[model samples]
Target: MTTPTSCAYCQQRATQLCAGCRSVVYCSREHQKEHWKRGHKRECKCYEVTSNELLGRHLRATRDIRMGEQIMCEAPLVVGPKVAATPLCLGCHRNLLAPQKPAMTFYKCSSCSWPMCSKECEKSPFHLDECRLMAASNFQSKINYNPADPEGKESAYCVIMLLRCMQLKRSNPEAFARLAALEDHLKERIETPLYQVLRANLITFIKTVLGQRDWPELEILRIAAILDTNAFEVRQNGERRKVRAIFPGGAMIAHDCVPNLRHRFDDNMRIIFLAKRPIPKGAILSISYTQPLRSTVQRRVHLKQVKCFDCACERCSDPTELGTFAGAHLCGKCKVGKVISQNPLENAANWHCQLCNVKKSAREVLTQDARLQQEIESLDKTTPVHLEEFIQGHRIDLHDTNTHILQAKYALTQLYGTAPGYAMDELSEESLKRKVDLCEELLQISNLFDGGWSIFRGNLLIDLEEALVAQALRLQLASECESKLKRAEELLEEIKNIMKHEPEEMQQMLAERQQILNAAMAPFSVGVE
Candidate 1:
């Protein structure tokens, strides 16, 4: 009707739409076949799923992609409450806050007898599929909707996602096929404690209570395994609502400590993957499955425990952790040398001081690291007093770039401006300078590990931008004020770009930031009354 846009292969007039996906238009049969042969055959969308023994199923770029390019935008196949989640609306997925009056109880769905926010939410599309299935089971939810402890997690919430997945077999077989095709790692997960619980509870509920005996025990467990491995944690509704969703295409992307891809969920809850840097064709696409601020050992352990895979990514293999030495500690013997692992990929490898050659057993290093972590965790973080003390006490033992130190610094960056009694205007001259210095140092580390439109970098930029603006407002000299203002302006522009794909709520916050920064920078004013 609209002339079919341009050909995907040649940028020429085209009418033939790709029959497989109907996403791309072809100029001619010859070009279509040629393009398919070139790589399009594998890519129904932007990246192609490929398999390897090391990484299992992984995605690769079908064509060269520019930085910040949106590579994939996929609607979730299924969405529901997390495996262990606080009480939330079954329909809207919003947190169910405790009622103001002690006697009042949460509204339950008329059909399913499950908690919902409102009558409108009871009719929500997300609730309908499960409402019908759950209603038919003649089983009423006994969630013990206690108004006193509304935020407490319900074990029953876990059954909803599994039921939704099981329903897809009849409701949407095509989507069910995609879900089935996903790597479940069931063999590896079957012996786990969680699976045993599922075997006793979830399997029995589906077969005996719900009267779904056709679904095999192994098949039911496989679905749970697939969800555990592939589901992405989704936070929405201004982050008050927490849920998990399965994006089949998104799960195909591999994991790396220093990943090339950054993903965000849109208002529609569709997962969008963007290239954080320019990616050459044939390169594998990756995103970090763990926190960027965690040390290599911490990340690797988390990956192995939850994901059931040993990560041998470039950043993990290098003991220096891309030269940040995030996991390294100060040598007790040398005092000057940084203690580093001999082989980062192996868990049992001995750590040695570079300068002193003092060897420490893996267990010894791990025990020391864990103790330090507990020390940091135990600190009273409401004020900067304990964090500052921790940093000063560990200066000789833990460098600024050490993972624990970085974690504290990042927290400080958030606390300085917003924390009660430590607001920007209330900050002393020394504390203001400290905030600026902390931000500048962290920005450098962020560039190395999570650079190029990453959420980590964007958040750091936001902090730095605000700090710079505050500094500019306080400075006496016009030139210094102007320089700080200029840098703040540049940072705000980048933040806008990085957060372009974020939800409406985030955009609203950015808008507020823009207004505040603009007011501060108005008329190039520097002198105070």
Candidate 2:
């Protein structure tokens, strides 16, 4: 865990990491001198790495923590590409740009022919160790970028992160030890289909092609399983560029669907975690490993598949899904009734309608739900007609707060402001009002599950604020515009509080948003939100 540095004299946040010992920090040179005289000279030392297995390798607070306080900031031990449906740069993990013309080929590394973004990425330190081994063994990448495939097919990217972890054993023994010590769940994984596939393909390829024969087969597989258990999906600007990273301190936090801790990555790729709410002393810090908007069944399946545990958190056990009813559907016999799982903790249990008390088998519910999801997925999201039609058609079977409806509504909010035919300025008064209704209703549902400071909530507030501003612009009366502008100001403040610890890209957007609101309000001599 990191020891946050403070200014020696003034006790303000430190902005400089010390050069001499690479340990302490100071806000200014004068404070550094004062601190050096007052016990810093003798006491300042490099932080010692420590481990605890008190709760089987989870983190604990050494001191009292307040809301929005940064507990720890850590650099990733290893960073590499994820198993992606889309082709991505092995180094940066951005979606690979498809060749404009048919004859052009995808980029590859000069040394090993592995997929990479450019010549600069071909020489990255992270790629060097794996590149050397692959080149030495005469291995070449078969991963190709296909322009026609929206999700570019590339199965070979899966092995890149695993290869990087294996190379650490020889290149850096200390990091290798830390990597080995993480939980692997080898007992559970060996029986899984993925591990079976790895045995047939990945294991044979490494030994026969890449020729790392000296490394034990089980150990190599164990490292891969360990990464699946603990590695964080690190990304900047939310969805823009994503890669897997292992942060020893940050990984120790446990999981909760409605987590009290929120995290963000810095420009240097350091994980910075802050309290999402007022956490008491000795409370175990946690972060959500799954999406907040997903229903209990969805979250449970994802957690069990990836993290290998069935969550029984407060929100997960509640049948109403923390009152959002994101998974609930209307009864077939009685349209007034809402159907929910009888026992949320057990996946195979029965579901019953609340008003009519009619029962349905778990298999029946699962199958029908999947069909609906598939039908929704097939809709073209670029325009609003199909989605609007879907909502109208399913109104009897699925309620307003059903998961598929919520998903469609979220998509429409984005489409309204930027879709080809529905730009904000081009929207009719009725269309703008429709957008406001969707945002406000979704936000109320969001509060039940996502709560105050979640990223889901932050994004919703942003959409709502813009809608409110648009409504203000359309209104002719002074009293009506005043009401809309005040509500917009309220939402703007909430957006800042929620996204304060987000990435630099998000921060830039926030700054620009504030400026736009300021410029709009200046004509009325109003203050900044």
Candidate 3:
């Protein structure tokens, strides 16, 4: 017999509640709906559910979150041990630590006296703009100084946000001012959320709880929030959606081996999430927030050490989970067999099939993949000009849709139109058509993987339309060239629609393509039958 709790909004006995924020509760579905409508929307986390010590804790919804909706927009809480940072506290951005040894020395914050690990870190380009402001502030607490520590290690989430803000400040002052004024506490901490949180909590804890104004624990938490927020999400260009590394707030979403959501970033650095599959109500929505290519043991180890969670997600619990997706290969002996896991976590495996018996270790497959990747990386930048052989070599080891292979194909597509090498002007008509076919094939895959209004798809369409026009012109048939030109116009219209938001860049490309199209049509437009 458990006691019923009251809702934070309407004061009714609540059974269903949020698990993250724990600031609100709900009596029933109807009450929850009514309360949500009345203005509990922004701070409501009713959908999130997690257990603390096995007891369900309900958190309030922070905003009226739709399915696959973004609930909060946060800034990074800290900056960096920048490859180029002047002696600023990566935690507070104060000129605290100083360089201990100039040659053996990494730059340390003059104020905090904390030294970074490397000179490159001391010279991070991202840290340059902020160094001046940090230096000018006299490294003292002003009315604008809100010094609050974050919940854990410096939040990479906050640090990255601050860096973006600082960059914005340099490029667009009005926008920067607007962001700075968004929260009063932020302004005091030089518009840093990590500092505001730390200041508020540290002040209260010291005055009310411990009767002290400062604590080392507070500083540690501030640093943690900074690290959590500032970490970068590095990814390749054509990945349908930008994939960012999980930051602090994002990292808190928890893990499920069978995740419900997938996320990608835009060029502008906004995080977007999609429903990988339909999720029912009361379901705990989750995203992997990590590299899906890693093994269970590797993933769990990284998550535990870096994120402080023991992931018992379904993928982690099963030995063969994710099907050892990252490390699978064909069997050489059987020729028709696939390698599989005997124990995925332990990296022990055997390759066999229903018809034959064969075996291989995880190490052998991983080493092979690594070797292939290294070789692929070693190719000269101009290799795309010789796309046929490049693609053929990749096919030997990498799957058609593997990220690296897809990237290579994208480069090949661009080269078909732009490459000025021997392969370009010397291309045979049949060879040119083959290149067009390859572009079409790759575009179809791009649509499947990253089709949500992507510029890559638009560019591919533009290139294909141009190739078709060229093919028609070469035939020296007026009527046929005109028809192909019409098709090119249609393709351009489609590109315009997708690129409406990027009018300048799209217009420039459109203008260039139109000139080429006009030249192709000039011979057809003259007086003729």
Best-fitting candidate, scored by lDDT = 1
Question: lDDT (CA) for every model shown?
Answer: 0.87, 0.79, 0.50
Candidate 3 stretches with Cα past 4 Å from truth are 1-328, 336-348, 351-355, 385-407, 420-431, 454-507, 510-529
In candidate 1, what are the lDDT values of residues 1-529, reduced to their tens digit? 2335788889898989876445689989998998899888666665677898998888887667788888888899999999878778888788776344333467898987888888999999888988887788888887655656656778888999998899999989999999999988888889999999999988999899888999999999999999999999987767467799999988989999889999988777889899898888789999999989888998998998888889999989999999999999887887888999999999889999999969999999899889999999999889888899999999988988999999899889988988889999999888988998998999899888898889999998888888888889888998898888988889899999988888887789889989988887776754745
Per-residue accuracy of model 3 over 400-504 as CA lDDT, tens digit each:
544455556666777775666525455678756866886787667644433433455667887787787767767766777788788877887777665554435
If the candidates were sorted by their TM-score against the true structure, best first, what order would they fall in? 1, 2, 3
Candidate 1 TM-score over all chains jointly: 0.89
Better model by lDDT: candidate 1 vs candidate 2: 1
Question: What order do you get sorting by lDDT, best first?
Answer: 1, 2, 3
Please provide, for model 2 over 398-460, each residue's C-alpha lDDT reduced to its tens digit, 9 standing for 90 to 100.
888888898888888777777888999988888788888888888887777666577777888
Give the C-alpha miss distance for residue 242 in model 1, angstroms. Answer: 1.3
All candidates: CA RMSD in angstroms?
Answer: 5.0, 5.6, 13.7
Which is the better candidate, 2 or 3, if ranked by TM-score?
Answer: 2
**Root-mean-square deviation of Cα positions for candidate 2 versus the true structure, in angstroms:** 5.6
